[model samples]
Target: MTLSIDNLQQMEIEYIKMFSEVSEDEQTLTFNNSNIPDMYTHNFDLYKSDVGLLEYIESQINKVETKAKGFFRIETYHPISADLIEKLSVKPQICTYDFMGIETRNYINLIGNPECSVLSAESSRVLEDGITVDIAVNEEGMGLDFATRRIKGKAEVYKNPDKAIELFVCYSGDTPIGNIEYIPFNRVAKFEDFDILEDYQRRSFGTSVLKHLLEKAFDNNIEHAYLITDQADTAKEMYKKNGFEKVGEKTELLFLF
Candidate 1:
């Protein structure tokens, strides 16, 4: 019992249709039943016609969710039919959509760019939820320490106070209005190099921090840089300005977590 390419294609379409009804999110479409493997593929004509990929995706998600043994995944070009994308009921596990990229050579060029030069412009080195911040870095050379620890996977346990990093912003004060922490990545691709407090968003701060991070990666001899964000958001456009193009789409990998 073997399936031809055409048979597989048809099965793919059929599976897509079935998943759409149950999942309501076409992005979760996957061939594997136990888990949605993270696969990155792209089609430029996804939005050439009215109700083209969106319709197909919706139909497929419905089919998969109805028979979900685990999870589902899908990726497409930006500007997916907003109305259709809203219908998806899939619980977004981890969204790695808005990815930015720059040539290894241009790493230095981006350093002086206005987007990365502003004094007020800061990096999202830490992310927080009101009182409890998941991460932090200090002015007395603590951020680099935490970053090194995080990348080395030794700072996983933050229960010890010394393990934290003390981060700062443009504003000058004894206590920061908002705290920043060092969120280091194993690979220097995705999440804008770091995360910051939710309060200090939309000021174009992350752009600057990312530039600094790029410089650091370059110093470390990294040739290429990248990051990912929600596929259907303004972040995609933001990355475009930063010189990142869609290389491919990665389907959800259920068992990784």
Candidate 2:
């Protein structure tokens, strides 16, 4: 099939929907928990006028009062006016992600590396000598709070029994330094949460893990291989080197109280 903008947008929608534990609609997604700072997800493309944006922003504030309690966030596919920030009385949090999909031509053939081996193991699978593959949510222990990193908290997915996610952790010499997630939806294998420890980076471990996943993609008959990354220079560079490009982008806004 063709990799269209619509396809990329849908992937992002589904990715965020996985966290909708309270309510979800065409325009907004509200998480029920207050401790989770990113309790609201603004999914509409309604940046036509300042009035429309203000109305939408107010609704989100009202929803926060009705839904979750703690600090909240609004993520939009369209850009809003700076005036909206003053009206809503919320701080502006800017973030960008490159929706990258692997092209057909780039998949010349399935290749594996000798250093980093891929294993279909559990997240807790320990490595005695080398890094073993495992799974987990790629969140920093500080929860979803955007202001401070001092509070070490985890996402609810870690404790939710309904969550169906498999985290891939790569270890190098008995140390867990690299990680990724395999989200298979609609017969498409989406690789996300790709990260490597700072000390272990630039050592070909990331490339090897990516290639290992690609090698598995061949046998799975996956319709697509893709991932979304933030503005991390090192990770972005690695993805571009391995044949990934920015297909689309979305705007994310965070509010703290």
Candidate 3:
């Protein structure tokens, strides 16, 4: 059985909320990074309908083990009986164990706040950089209202706010052009880590702003930072220039039965 994108998205949303709830007690449980994009489950029936979802989970668990650090183990919880299984024992894949699986997915890389040097010379050299931007942290209702118009002309993705800190940025003229939506991760213990997005990409505006943000993160006592980028994106080099190392990977898997 194949799941529609809408159904997949809905499942993801539910899982995000579930992870958020889990984070309330244990701050380490979040679903925004690498292979576990946002697989939330409000209705187990949806997953049950798909015979191969369990295999997908198993593959993801193995993949995560190879690519990420900090988590000791992954488990699946059955809501009704409060039963937890360390490894999904079901075999949804019909084939024999004759081949290995490889895939990729969209995810955000997280890092603890850490101090690092980013070349401010690039932003200063860009004569097109003319806007004065100011970022406001966690003042959602009003700040978003003030920043929405600026964001209208740009790109954005919202992380799970409950497990992470929320940020809102505005310009001096009440026009916001860029934003960084992120969560608090303690793994990269020396860096105040975040994912940055800008409405405009030409002038190194977003990169410049991110440099400042990292500076602030360092001031707050952070050491390392990480972010997940599409394999096609060249900006990975920028992250490297700023002192982040590629510590893990996430792949997407599609299941059809």
| Whole-model lDDT per candidate | 0.37, 0.55, 0.33
List residue ranges in candidate 1 displaced over 4 A.
1-99, 111-131, 134-194, 253-257
Candidate 2 segments whose C-alpha is farther than 4 A from its true place: 17-19, 32-51, 62-68, 81-88, 104-113, 126-164
lDDT by residue (tens digit), candidate 3, 79-135: 212122234443222211111111111012323223222222113221111112322
Model 2, span 1-257: residue lDDT tens:
86665676566556655654446556554444334444244222223232365677666656756245454455555566666667775555667666777753355543434466555435335321112212222234424333121112222343344654455657665556666666665555678656676666677787778777766665667657788778665578778888777766666665545
| Number of clashes recorded per candidate | 38, 5, 27
The TM-score obtained by model 1 is: 0.38
Q: How many pairs of residues collide in model 1?
A: 38
